[model samples]
Target: MSRIRATLVATAAAAAALLAPLAAAPAASAHGWITSPESRQGFCAEGATSFDCGEIKYEPQSVEAPKGSTKCSGGSSYTILDDNSKPWPRTTTGTTVTFQWKLTAAHSTASWEYFLDGVLYRTFDGGNKQPPSNVSQTIEGLPTGDHTMLVRWNIADTANAFYSCVDLHVVAGGTDPGDGGTTTPPVTTSPTDPTTPTSPGTCSAAAWSSSSVYLGGDQASYNGQIYRANWWTQGDTPSNTAWGPWTLVGSC
Candidate 1:
């Protein structure tokens, strides 16, 4: 073969090899964010806030970056999340709050971390396995006040982690945010009644019925525990675990 023909073929092969990776490179595999207690991204995605949210409103699950970032954006391109100047709506809650996450592409997770205004407060073992599409974790003994929380979902096999920020206005005896701004009414009792409980927390809530429709903050007693509905639900049994729409408030 002629030298020029051989040289031309070799150059073409090299160019193709260089361009192949650029054409076929895959995007990073990461997804998920706290939805309940409505994270900043969650509020944006739901159109619950009036401020401009940029692309994050459309892709709430993509705030991913290296695992070490403390920023709400996780150092990703969604920097609008880090802006405190925006009037971000805060979830009002009691000392105990339940956080729920929605996963589009679940990964083998290493751990889940919760930070309150940049301080690590709680963590859950991910078991280094894929998680369900809907996952919930409740944090007990949370300090009451207005605060920002940063949540991290660490991938087991990758250096990337998903980050979300949630604003909370925790007040004493406050109900969960989804409860539509009303506090549970105090149970009434007569002084002549000998069977009435002395404490409100110990008072028996209305018994949960399978045929009844309940809305957010609606309380009922189920299996000796007091449970509150996170949202409109019917026939879902109240549970203390992270799997159901009912949140176990305390023992009746």
Candidate 2:
């Protein structure tokens, strides 16, 4: 009986030791990403732009890598972000703009850096303290034209940083400064010619909407062509023919 009791005591001690580190471990590492003016990952996660975004569609906040990289992915494994060929929707704004960040796990910060066309333009100190879930940063005196802005959220406690890339079509005196989140509306044909197709053939389906959900076999007209959805999808442009959910049925 004494020997059996000793074995049980030893087993309990070992179990407690194994559980100690588990209890001390930190919580899940959830990071953040830009929302307003929509980063590349943001558009992919929202399914509003590209359809070929691999794993980034699920993990927009995970574009984290070591510091000192200029690429959109920041030298992370998310190489899709570095592909500028993707049709990232550009936000139409004036010379001044405000970027909104959505933080999932706001860690201790070092500084926020912004680069326009690979040139450092602004940096905000983080005071070495944790930040709130929602943080907004405004950048002023931007030049007018198409520009790619790279944002970095450097962590004070770690060598890693979160990166986001935003494409903007800055006009001399464009959108209201207060309307930082708004995007340029897509051009559409007149609705008075509903019976008449925008192209050569008759439009047999409704015009595709970015906000509408399309299921399998559903048809929609886009870019003078009629497309059929292979499966359920939303926010995916119908003109994406290569491996997208849309299949070009014919010209409308």
Candidate 3:
């Protein structure tokens, strides 16, 4: 009887251990962030685009706050995002720009809003449904010049919202300030001749994982090349197909 009881107890312990991860999965409020055009949190999370970022440099997707709040940091511990005086990298773009968000854990959303200089710019209604692994929307009518863009994702079922900020430099269409009238002689080379290969920039900060769902602007290294996802994808190798989800960015 003692031996049988010990065996049963061992089996129960094993089962509990296997179920622990599922029970401890991250809550819906714990995930999400803007990646494309590189939000303040996104830039710090990758350890790129140097700036004095606080704790956001560690976990960009973790910012959370109640709805109707306009603070850039979303009341997160990483309050450095609220500092606009610090020079942030600007993304050169047009009036109509597509913004992307990555969601590690999907939640029912009330709406997504964009702000410019403390004014509401655009809104995307989510209809209280779970959002996709990746979310993107094109915003138009932005005037040319430097502008601060803030994106907010309001949770429908909860009072909290996620926030991200990006600096943009919009330019007028068809205005090309070419090479200042300077020209260089073209160098000729044989098509069949072998040449020394060069490095492909830098490898991704993280390894690619099949179990992980990547969103736009997320970088991963696979098979010696670093890639940025154009949208949401999983288990896709970088630079393997013309229309593949991954965009080759560098070499690992």
Candidate 4:
């Protein structure tokens, strides 16, 4: 098993040498984070059947975080920045990660970049940013015992290079690579009562409101989950009072 793992690591290093970067730890609120004027992710998405950004692509992209929607469905594509963005699980040495990425349109040339301690390490930027390049880079030089591998995206050209797809595979110490293998643990879900009820009794069509509800960015509780659409209260008929001002459920 160790031998297999060793071989896998070597192969991954080689492939990553050929390819190129990109998690999150969620808490009650967004706090203490590494912010950068320049921030990005190398998404490792293999392809689109599902909306998965495998990892952050070093290439430029338009993949922004969602505004207000269930799942990572719709919103402007976000540029990578650690400025109190969604928290990600810690990264460390001997961790083998793998994923895919895509760009809106490739320029002539691009580069590979590595960040150490929340700073830019090396950039493989060439003459232009046009190539639909596949990249992979390993984080060498670990300081003693443990550290977090915070990776983001950087474009040869922000104007020309726009990202489309990505995904990631990273595990501390060692493990087979795939999209941050540790995601929300497998759940055997059953319907539970709402901690706070919108209606006095049961939620009903009659309880629905149509007041123009403004879904604010600050009200976003889940990293990429939308509360507006889900558990929305509609009006009896399209009246001015019922016309709308719908607030997201459970989020004042």
Candidate 5:
């Protein structure tokens, strides 16, 4: 009887070890940071005439923008733009993102209005007809995914120029800043905990973002859990042309 009991105990220990959960793997590191900057034609205008341009700046220290807003040293005719509005090809959503930009000169008024996907977000002045240089984020928040962030200095005038973002990665996780203990909604698989309170009116874990479409896949590395490849996946289509890796999900 004692011998039999020992065998049973050993079997249980082996099974327990096999079923134990593993720690999460690190997320794939983001690669290919901007290595080279594109050439800028580089225009300059300072303390000129109103409706023409006095002092101006390229908002949001960035390398992708070609034309930027101009600030004036005197008077306000800073309105009217048929060719003044433009946007970056990127997407937005989530909480917020910071932008890098440089200025050539300062507008006399030093203020700017921003538009996110055609919706007005906020506006601020550039202040002083100062020389153009570099500036950080002037505005924040614009829905997630792809979006157009337009900063027009003289909305009514085009001579002032504009700064458009080509691609803005708003990133995910648009949780409220004031709230604590908030969790992101799960997608495909049920969340580990259903009772866990989610942000009010947040989509369930099964719901995917507008940019994230379900497709076939071969493999996935989520939180260190390696889901192998199969045919006809539901998470995402394989990046490659051949199809074999399947992304399993709750299709129903």
Candidate 6:
């Protein structure tokens, strides 16, 4: 009986040791991506039927970079979100639409911005507090046509921002465009030729300056390539490094 009791005590101690880390682990940081209108990352995560997306198909909530960039993927390794050549699934909605973001980990936010054709269409101030697991915002007065909508979440305390791209087909009062709708014009240039000219009226490349604070949607030229900043940033060079502030859009 004495031996048995000693063995049980040792077993209980081992079990307690195994459970300590689980009890002490910190809460996960904010991790999420847009779901409604099916953002590019969302579609990829859901196994998109229209196009073959890259790694983003598995982890939609992982597209994160420093605030002040405009790229859909925020310069993350999920660069597939930036590939505008492939036809994306479009969600048809009215001039005013409610966009929804699904969150796995909620974090305090600085703000949420919606961009249409590289223009700020709407913005929601988050008040620097934790939001619900699902956040929704209504945007109005969008022109009738196809538009690439970029949803950006700016974390209040962190330097990072989450990004998702939703290709939208807004109709004034007509029928839904369905998933097989018109495609937005491609914005990225081929990697084979860095100097290849992009579509007319697209964002032009400017020289990167450490003194300049770049906002989302701002483009810069560095190392013979054109990069788009995901959010406000300075001093981060646009190189081949992953998770940097700048996403390589094309060769300059």
TM-score of model 6 vs. true structure: 0.58
Q: Could you tell me the TM-score of candidate 1?
A: 0.65
Q: Write the per-residue lDDT of candidate 5 for residues 25-112, one digit (tens) a residue.
A: 2322211011001001111111111343211222111212113432211122222211234221223335554432333233343445
Per-structure clash totals for the candidates: 0, 0, 0, 71, 54, 13
Residue 202 miss distance in model 4 (angstroms): 40
1-252: candidate 6 lDDT, tens digit per residue: 999999999999999999999999644343777666668876665555477776566567777888988899788777878888878888888877667776666889999999997788889999999988667776778899999999889999888898988998888874432222222212222433222434434345778888886643467887676777643467887764444556666654
User: Once model 6 is optimally superposed onto the true structure by TM-score, how far is the C-alpha of residue 234 displaced, in angstroms?
Assistant: 39
Q: Taking the tens digit of each residue's C-alpha lDDT, what string does model 1 give over 1-252?
A: 699999999999999999999989657554787766888987776666888798777677779999989999999899999999999999888887777776767799999999999999999999999988667777778889899989999999988999999999988897654323222222112232212223445646899999997754577898777777644567988875453567656666
Q: Please tell me which model should have the higher TM-score, number 4 or number 6.
A: 6
TM-score, model 3 to reference: 0.61
TM-score of each: 0.65, 0.61, 0.61, 0.30, 0.30, 0.58
**Clash pairs (backbone) in predicted model 2:** none
Q: Best candidate per TM-score, number?
A: 1
Which segments of candidate 2 are over 4 A away from where they belong?
Answer: 1-28, 176-252
Q: List the residue pairs that clash in candidate 1.
A: none
Predicted structure 5: clash tally: 54
Give the residue spans of candidate 6 off by over 4 A.
Answer: 1-30, 174-252
Estimate the lDDT of model 2.
0.77
RMSD of each: 12.2, 10.9, 10.7, 22.8, 24.2, 16.7
- Is 3 or 4 the stronger prediction by lDDT? 3
Off by over 4 Å in 1: 1-3, 6-30, 177-252
lDDT of each: 0.77, 0.77, 0.71, 0.30, 0.33, 0.72
